[model samples]
Target: MIQLTVNGKPRKADVDPDTPLLWALRDSLLLTGTKYSCGSGLCGACTVHVDGQPVRSCITPVSAVAGKKVTTIEAVDGSRVGKAVQEAWRKLDVVQCGYCQSGQIMSAVGLLSKNRRPSDADIDAAMAGNLCRCATYVRIRAAIHEAAKALA
Candidate 1:
């Protein structure tokens, strides 16, 4: 059994040590907010927080997450930055097809946590991994700025 903390709770999964964390989260833990796209880390759809730092779950082994905290979008509301980002996302309607929004939101949370006021360049640099097929980039940028202002 691989032991890990997910969404602030202790979780134990009887699975292969080499199994990817994405499967552990979605299949065992049932935290499905983290999407699976590209599966090769090219897309940020599998983004999740490993001890508050954004990491791609699809490529990370479940054993690597053992004894560490894994924060998914389901639990992002636990932090002030996360709350602000989520509120901004909701208020601005930043979701397009919604398939990528969870990853986008995770990436945004990672960005805003380090920089309270991120410029467009900073946002772009941080969000370069996440892609929205609906091309919601404009609203996303605006929402991130709005969230930064709200955080301030």
Candidate 2:
């Protein structure tokens, strides 16, 4: 049994240690908000917070995060930064196709949690790994700025 804290709750997953954290989250723990795309971790669809840092769950082994805290999109709104980012995302209509928004939101929250104010360059650098098929980069950047303002 692999033990970890997810969304502030203690949980156990009866899976192989090498199993990707994404499967453990989606299959074992039933937290399906974290998406699976480009399983090689090239895309940010599987982004989640492990110890307050965003990580690609699709390529991360469950064992790698053992005994650590793993936060997913489902619980992101619980944080102040997350709530601000999500509110900005909604207000700015940042969702294009919605498939990548969860990851995008996760990454945005990650960026804002550490840096209260991020310039366009900082936003681009931080969000470089996340891909949006609909090309909503403008709105995403706007939402990040809005969220930063709200946070301030």
Candidate number of the best TM-score: 2
State the lDDT of candidate 1 residue by residue for 119-138, as single tens digits. 99999998998988899999
TM-score of 1: 0.97
Give the per-residue lDDT digits (tens) of candidate 2, residues 1-152. Answer: 99999999999999999999999999999999999989999879999999999999999999999999999999999999999999999999889789988899999999999999999999999999899999999999999999999999
Q: What TM-score does prediction 2 earn?
A: 0.99
TM-score of each: 0.97, 0.99
| lDDT, model 1 | 0.93
- Where model 2 places Cα greater than 4 Å from the true spot, the runs are none
Clashing pairs in 1: none
Lowest-scoring 10 consecutive residues by lDDT in candidate 2?
A: 93-102
Model 1 weakest lDDT span, ten residues long: 37-46
The model with the greatest lDDT is 2
